[model samples]
Target: MNDILFRHNRPDRAATFEEYRAEGGFQALQKALADLSPDAVQQTVIDSGLRGRGGAGFPTGKKWSFVPRNLPGPRYLICNCDEMEPGTYKDRVLLERNPYLLVEGMALACYALGVERAFIFIRRGYELAALNLKGAIAQTHKAGFLGSAICGSGFNLELDVHQSAGRYICGEETALMNALEGIRANPRSKPPFPAVKGLWGQPTVVNNVETLSNIPAIVAHGPAWFKALAATPEGAGTKLFCVSGHVQSPLCLELPIGTTLGEIIDTHCNGMRTGSTFKACIPGGASTPYFTKDHWTVPLDFDPVAKAGSRLGTGGIVVFDQSTCMVAATLNLVRFFARESCGWCTPCREGLPFVQHTLERIESGRGDLADIDILREHVHKLNYAFCALAPGAMGPVEGLLRLFEDEVREHITGGKCPVKG
Candidate 1:
């Protein structure tokens, strides 16, 4: 009953094109192409208060407006589908179940942003989802909704799904652009911002898959309707939460944005699993800080979660039971980052391994009070790395330092892991 982006996603399989149409899937695209001016379309999204679902939570409409009007040559729009973050897989679900959502959403965004060439920079591991998107694009083209004169609106467009080299750095916008150009996927410096110079140095707008996917709904339902979908008055629309770990049912459910974390656990997941009790959770994705029981009641939205001390990243909620050691959990995540570092800068290249080593030592009972202080110092140091990767890697570590210092002290005091015991 609860639906929007996932309205047509049946439990057995993905909805067919005909089924999607029956539910008024393409109607939003038709409305935008037929009635609304580009500015009007952008304005609708602005009024709807739709924020990006791909972690940053930036306003989607405002990002579209950043492209200079009628800029010469070709402007580009990229749907960032490189879902490599640990504890995050929401975009893969959307693409797998309803590929048209992304196709239509990207098309709608192209109209608003004057983008003729669009790319879905996807992670290579999502083979099925990528195939589905390719199929969806073909379907739209055959129906005269893609290629030239889309929906008879004279908005000629071409879409492509470009497979990535399977690197975590490609999730970063500038790094993605570099990867698209067949260059090494290193983070680019900001200030020229993609809206000004991107995708072969032309004006471009890059959006997360979920961010672009919200466009069609905003155009179809009106801004007020979109805003009303969120559980909270200030938020807009439902968020697809990818839940995992220690729950009775670890599922990706579309709950109204701002639904309390406790509600997600109790209602959708049916609470914690047998023999396990909730101890902490990564309120958003793996890159977000951990939330202890104190945050169970916190609204799982951007601002509220941020206010509660973590970014609402990717809306991927990974829980840890009381049996889990925060030190060990954080070390695993940091090690992944260490291996994934693009070797772009010294801090990330050198510091992440050090961070991992510190956590490993702490978990192995070799750490002292001095090691704890150094861990805290590394958290601050990594934040200044060349890209968000190292900083994001420190999220769980920061949480351990802040919330589990006592447990860390136990390792030092007992000369062994108390949690392991």
Candidate 2:
């Protein structure tokens, strides 16, 4: 079966509503509205095992069902379009090429979650995506597919595009909600989960752009059809793996979740550059652990990646060849984490710089072994701070220390960067 979601992403003008409808878009919406019950819709998604494609691979249907069905106030669905992770930019492609797919998906999710108002929280940096999405929103509203009495089904719905003042922390669900409500972007404590006390203290469901894009498909094809799309035992469905760095073909390729890292490199990506040996890859964006050449056999999925002591974060497969210095690579990643820190808590704000400085010192061959110990200690102390930022910041640092200690030692003993003059 042809993968429909990314099929329209080539560099021409994006498909508008009329073009999308001509290509069988919104048939799923009509089917969903006319045939499926909200509970049935939720159940179909659960059975499909469609995990969120965002950094956190939370189960999608389960996240939606968290909203109280009978509870009466307004419920909201927010599509998280803040794609700020380093080495990750697939969401931008999705939003830019097929804004309607995301809108259709969000509308379907709103139907499933008993939500009437939905917002696509787009990042300000993505000016094109923001503009495209706003135009799509207007089209959706005018076509009777959105707004009051949608599709003549008497199901009133409203979809809006809200631009976020580009901040990495705003990608977090709670922080996204807080920002939506005109507050500073900071993560709210859980327990009174967003399903309960969310945006304006009402039920809210915040899903990643890719996650919401799967909803219309799930509703169109029954759960079994969607489940059979995956080539792995973990689940079904094709995923967009955005590969970058040192690879012969660096682009976003859609493959089944069970596709091996080696297949992706050798087949889709045309392997690492001709002279470069594949030293390692961060299987899933910046937060995942470094997978050595030995892990080429590991399947690319949430459970398998985690079983191998890493995660399939955002499905960003960043390749590193032999010429890349591990010490310098680690320093660069640490710098990203430090700079993106939201300053909401002390650990992320204060500790990240400390970690970055220590890593730079050790990598530059001007530090003691005690620096490694301090790095480890501070990572542990800082990781559990207020949000996922600090914890996520530890990923590359931990992997660098654990997987390439000898490389660090080599740099230290040799008194300079191994890859540099």
Put down candidate 1 lDDT per residue, 134-225, tens digits, no spaces.
98899888888889888878898899999998999899999999999999889899878999999898998989988888878888889998
Where in model 1 is the C-alpha error above 4 Å?
Answer: none
After TM-score superposition, what is the CA distance of residue 144 in candidate 2 from its true location, in Å? 1.4
Model 1, C-alpha of 309: deviation from truth (Å):
0.7
The Cα error of candidate 1 at residue 335, in Å, is: 0.5
Candidate 2 displacement at residue 138 in angstroms: 1.6
Stretches > 4 Å off in candidate 2:
9-11
The TM-scores of all predictions, comma-separated, are: 0.98, 0.97
* Candidate 2 lDDT tens digits, 1-421: 4485786555777888898888778888888789888888889889889899988889998888788877778988888888888888888888888899998888888888888888888878898988898889889888888888788786778888888888888889999998999988889998799988899999988888988887787787777887777778766787889999999999987788778999999998888898999999888888777999888988888888888888889998889998888878878887988888878898889999988888788777887777778878876887679988888888887888889888877777787877773
For model 1, state the Cα shift of residue 275 in Å. Answer: 1.0
